[model samples]
Target: MSEKRIEELRRQIQYYRDAYYQENQSLISDYDYDLLERELKSLELAHGVAEGSPTVLVGGKASEVFAPVKHLTPMMSLDNAFSEEEFLAWSQRAGGGPFLCEPKIDGLALSITYENGVLVKAATRGDGETGEDVTQNVLTIQGVPHRLSGSNHPAVIEIRGEVYFPLKAFEKLNADLVAAGKPPFANPRNSASGSLRQKDPAVTASRPLRMLVHGFGSFEGLNTQSEVYQLLESWGLPTTKQFAVAQDATSAYKFITQLSQKRHDLEHEIDGVVVKVDELSRQRELGATSRAPRWAIAYKYPPEQVNTKLLDIKVSIGRTGRATPFAVLAPVKVAGSEVEFATLHNQDQVRAKGILIGDTVVLRKAGDVIPEILGPVVALRNGSEREFVMPTHCPECSFELAPAQEGDVDLRCPNAESCPAQLRERIAYIGSRAALDIEALGYVSATALTQPLEPSQPPVQSEADLFDLTLEKLLPIRAYVLDPDTGLPKHDADGNPKIVDFFRKKDGSPAEVALKLLANLEEAKTRELWKILTSLSIRHVGPVAARALCNEFGSIEKILQASEDELSQVDGVGPTLASSIKDWYQESWHQRIIERWKASGVQLEIPDFAGPVLTDGIFSGMTIVVTGSMQSMTREDAEAKIIAQGGKASSSVSKKTSFVVAGPGAGSKLAKAEELGIEVIDEATFIARLAS
Candidate 1:
């Protein structure tokens, strides 16, 4: 290949790779991407290609949109080992014996920094040393803790780990995307990477991403690499349990081999196995090169591919009333499992691929990712082949599918309320963890409750039925069907083991589960008003906006009665959403559901939260200024304490200011308070007032 060709390939590969890994949106297939990268690598070796090729980069540069943060210690890359021989060579170079081997997760790398035993900063491993600050987004991650769990935590430490999207969550995310007429992500790693870099932290929080601590950057009171792992676990950080301490190359190689075999079985994706020297002192002595650490190595497995037939293509309607197309394939074994269905993404994707029915297709499955049709074998296509097309009308509701808005890709069915399929899915989203957080009410159970079975039971007609789910209605709700012979419930490609509630109980038995669920449903009815509002499936009303509405109106009645102008005044609730919220109440279906909910005794109003805030006590309506850092709490906390007792917290001290709470290092605000002849009190007096 020419130097120009290599340069073009390099930039193209990098852009697509970023879209794939960082944005969880892919522009090309894995094989196409691999071919481009391999071609660039080959040409670079021969032609001495241009400098700064993304092929040589560790990770994609942090997006410039976010504020940059530089690491105290440079986050370095590990040298690669494609074969056992290459890995064995590295083990020999490390001086042999006592190595730690853990799964090298195929996900985004992040650095989490803790100061004084509290998590203070979290950043992506951008271009190795420098990264974008993602502390807010990282805080929303379930596995990542805001505070260290144990008392034995390091005073100041920087822990490094991989953030990954689980397969099951990835499937749900892709389904939602498809429902919205958006393209599905290529794989879990790409999904995790893209989700973590979201500008809105709430968006990142909704993705099913988890972190596994593997190493540290700047640590105090830790002697060995093993201690780092132990400490991470003690601090309630998760680490891979499937690891081995190898004393020699043979043992290490054996563990890698074992992991390679078990890679497909993992819940999260792993590209390779990371082997590092056991001792921290030894790591320092071995030292690392500018490109990679000499003390550790990564043994990467080759990509797995399988050939299969694209039997048929079909479309499915989602809760959002968006149409998504998927392919039915002749069952073929991939990654040691039988696969049948794969997504074609959207109509644009189908046109781009030029795929036809009755064509031989190449399929590939990476660690824990769903098997995907790479492309069709044009040579193998016979005259019997037929071109596939997306339907003009909704398959479920029979309504004409139209683009959500002008030029939008998502083709949605306007029959959102009446559509049986959409209603079932919407109910599931209402009970989903991100919305109402109804315990044990997953998509399977939710759909089961909505979909009526034969002559025995009637389908749950509305949200009202959910609130009134008596024991009689619930006992027949199936979680999933069990395999008659294996006694194991069959799982989908994404490892969604829970099938939609068939008309029978699963291995756990739906009867006993119903008893627990009855109480759970009762508890769900009284959830926060914000949750109820968000779960109503109103357009433009997400978690953050819903919470803002709750803070503004404080009750369901107040929110519904709010004029469009008044609703727009709430922070984050724009004019568009305000209009949507008001219009939602106008819909006959919504009004019916509201009336039914009222009759069913569901909690429709926000709970009157009575605590700490002394409404009419002393300090009522007074403006209080807090300055400097208090010993017991921060300045913000001190100000919040004042506001809790029916007072207003002011940043500036003016003549009208009633009092100022001053602490050590109280500067301009304290001096201004004195100048204004405002009363100043110590933290002791402030605490005494709060107590009283």
Candidate 2:
């Protein structure tokens, strides 16, 4: 119980925590770590030691740049267990009925406060005690809900979530950084942290930052994570849809295993599973131990790394035209798959690590994803290593690349229309379900149909030819086929049919199975007209744009004949998109394809928009903030009614908020509204008001 003893324990525990969480390494076993934590807790309890005590909760401190905002409830770090044995032991100590296991996302912790169901403030988990306000930056995140819906609005709610940069986005960002002669971030977590910490809110907003609400920091009425998550969803906050309600520890472990396998598909970064008691009563019974909740523990996954030979370094031009270098590696086992490539990111990355062709580089699949060249081993490098150079022209089209606008290092392909890569990508975008309703075609299928059929041979000459593609003919088109026999492409004598033989069956005949798929596309043309226009592979046109274009022009044929000036008049269609749309329609082949599609019986009918029907009397013209629980209707449905009634549904409550709809266990929002003198209406009262 001495001061020296407490200080020593705090230092040791901090070291271990850092090593385990940040370094992904453990110096001692879970038992040893638990013992240290227990000793520290006992010392604090006996001597009333608080300052710098190991038992003192850590995390959520306000940064110097932003004014400190005190949390209604202190944010706490979760207890961690790296092994199953440790987890079982912790469960035994807690004596719980069930536990909820969630992925421990490797990202920055954030707290979003909603007033009357509208997002008002977002702050980082600065110190576990206080946090720096980053409201403006938070607004930029597309995933973060700007407004809430429904009749159930908490007066005030503080929802906690993890903001992370996805692997794909991180790679793209690092690629830009490298091309700009800047150092790439260490990992997605670091990238997310750096992005969120930017002084300029605009800079943070520009990044592909996403968030997932995992828990609540303070809720007036919400008592459990499950309830809180449901409430968050009702308020249009982004919560993980994959959360499982495990009945017991065994089920919890099973859920963890299931999530581990599926985590890679998730957009955010997750390092481990977070296990917590599902029941609020049980969680209260389990209580806390000063630093972490006894009800929750984070089950950390083992770090994954791999060794791969750098076969070559290639530069890829992005949408922005920035050339990013990546390592084409000799297939090596990492995470769960054979990683054949790792992102070199940018030129700065290549320079910093000296990544070269023929180098044996250490590759790490962080969070079980995104193969990245950790660094090259100088000792392993031979004299034959080749340096990579940024490409001056588009690799696909040889078009001169243009640098980004002033103060930007990214380069973009100025040839947006003629560039094959951009063209293909554009096709994929137009053909997406939301845009064109092209059910039979996807990016891969469309690419296969569009790619050059033979060496120096033109691709399926026109979109009309796509309709002509029979399964049998497609099998020999090496670009479209996957050989059934070898699970690899069956090469032709000249190797020119690499893609052709790929789609073929083992019998050398076009696969009947493949034919059936193409036949379905033939039938889908009769389904709708929007499908045809959306499938035209127009540049910069997505489903929303396609719909807008269709609504304005009436049909694909009409849209094509329209001048650029006329096309630009559409709600969402800008000048660039208008030119692309006009150009696509002007193409001789494109016109022929449209004729073929119409002949095939595709009908493009304008969707009928019925006038708004009001359901309730009181809700008309009144702005409502929905935050907490609602048993009557799903949040989406509730919002629809509000909008239908000419009323607005918001996410957070503010001074302008007319009323807060408080449902069962309405949390912090309720308390905040009381303080602000905002009228709080319960679900019953809300329904009554609607009826009135």
Among these predicted structures, which one has the highest lDDT? 1
* CA error at residue 437 for candidate 1, angstroms: 51
lDDT of 2 by residue, 450-498 (tens): 5545552434445555555565456655464433211123456787544
Measured by TM-score, the strongest candidate is 1
TM-scores for candidates 1 onward, in order: 0.47, 0.47
RMSD of 1: 18.2
lDDT to native, each model: 0.74, 0.66
CA error at residue 606 for candidate 1, angstroms: 70
lDDT of 2 at 53: 55
lDDT by residue for model 1 (71-102), tens: 87888877777788888888889988689899
Models, CA RMSD each: 18.2, 14.4
- Candidate 1 TM-score versus the reference: 0.47
